[model samples]
Target: MTASTLARRGLGVTVVERSGDTGRTGAALSVPEGLLERITGLRSEQLPRTLAPGVQSWFAVHTALHAAAAADLGIHFRENTRVVEVGQDTDAAWAVTAEGERIHADILVGADGHRSVTRRHVAPDKSDARYAGQVLWIGVAEESAIGSRGWPASVAFQHGAGYTLIGYPLPGADGSTAPGARRLGWALYDSSRDDVLRGSGALVGSVVQHTLTAPEIPEHTFEELARDARRAFSGTWRDAMVDSIRRRAVIGTPVAEYVPDRLVRGRVALVGDAAHVANPMTGRGFAESLLDAESLGAALSSNPGRGDRTRALLHYELDRLDAVREFVRSGR
Candidate 1:
């Protein structure tokens, strides 16, 4: 997002990614009207119609942003490049890749992620994002598989027995909202899964290691989730969930939260999960990342050259650090 936003301000960006052609699943995003245009500086007509405002697939939003970044001539991607270390001197910030290539820019933006290497350089004392006390079981169900049922007009919330479920309607992959073409996306927050996480080694002490896919989940765990769905949710939400369970389409993500002690240092800065990780249940992570990019771009929009990079970055930190800290702390 920082890449596209900086590109919007006509700054060249070299994105150092760990992999090429990445994918995500089992999550929904709140895409506000003109969100894509705001993030990418791309015209609405140039974006995919599937990226319209409303609840959207996480994968769809990511793909759209990747496409938008690709379309921008100012943005350059170094796919499959891993940044092992990040540093900055008085003049500039740079990243050292695994292949020994030191990529330097006028200013380096570490939009890396929750497990950010850049974060290590920015806040060494508070480098890791600690695991929150819940695991989110996320899934998407095809309306066609669920048969005839009244479609959800808006987001639904159900809370019972230490469990919270949020279910919302999403357009089909083709952006169709018709009865037969729509989809259901749900996230179930279970606070009683600490043992499973520890046993699977997906959680070490308090840090999250990975998300658990269906293939990795124990059969009894799926059974328990299915049983809980019937007890905790009702009506269409329950039906969609039961179907998803039967199909074993769920993935368990041990939630993590981070309160930033700092978001910037010198010419290097942090954004998104790299800076602060909010509670997933707040549904604010994606939007907050957009805000980070927007604020970063706006902060540096005027400082085109490298004369005052530190001041501009400090301004970005001042703009976001407190707000993002409050957002994360409140979501807890």
Candidate 2:
């Protein structure tokens, strides 16, 4: 989205992605209503029918969120263009080599996910991706199937002590889908080091499989799972929360990591999870991504001169750094 906004405003914007397509299959995204309105020009109701409407004001729980509609803005996204290296051209414009092709642009924005290639190119001395000691398993179920009203309703939450499971409605597909087809989703959070879960994809897989067996289970079951799912840990999960999640659930793991530095040189910047990732507990990634696009676009628009633009990039980095640093601290 930021790439498109920059290009539309007359900046040379090119996006390089590793995937062959952008709309890859995955769970729906939750975005803020205002961000959606500002970017896409769509009111909440105007969002894709498939998007479920969850509470927009809460982060402790998940919901079906909307992104603003920016009809005038569209980006030509290229898939399968993995950024292998990043450097500066003699003129100081950012040069990026992806796959086998090379690209030169006035500025570079890394919207890549957590394991960002741009971060490595700009700051090779940085540490490896660190895990956030928590995992989230998400899936959608019918709203009515659960015999519940619609959005604004809390599915279930067990925030006792160290473990938690939050459930909420996300918007859904068109009429072909049922009403309560209101996306029922949940996140299972456990705190532990990644090494403890080492090579235990099978163990993680089994735990998720077990979660689906019942409509609800004691949250303590989750605490046990969290501990047994890896090496010994003192962390605990609520019992009632685990039971509720098990009743209707889909399993997933939301791994977290962050880049200590926000800016890569003067010409390159990182956004979204590529810059910093908050614990899924914050549920703020989508909101931050939209804001990032707006901030970067405004900075470039305000400072068109090379010198001013370079400084603008620095300002942009500083602004996001403050926000991301706070996000990291809050998650801790």
Candidate-wise lDDT, in order: 0.87, 0.53
Q: Which residue pairs come into collision in candidate 1?
A: none
Residues 1-332, candidate 1, lDDT per residue (tens digit)? Answer: 78888888878888889978566667888887788878866677887967898889988888878888898889888999899999988877899999999998888888888889999999999999999899999998888888656778999888976798898899988788878998899998998989999989889999988888888888999999898889877778888889888999888999999999999988889999899987887777888988999999888975656797788899899999989999999888
Q: Model 2, stretches more than 4 Å misplaced?
A: 21-29, 40-74, 92-98, 143-152, 159-162, 175-178, 192-197, 200-251
Model 1 regions more than 4 Å off: none
Global local distance difference test of model 2: 0.53
Deviation in Å, model 1, residue 72 alpha carbon: 1.0
Q: Where does the lowest 10-residue lDDT sum fall in candidate 1?
A: 19-28
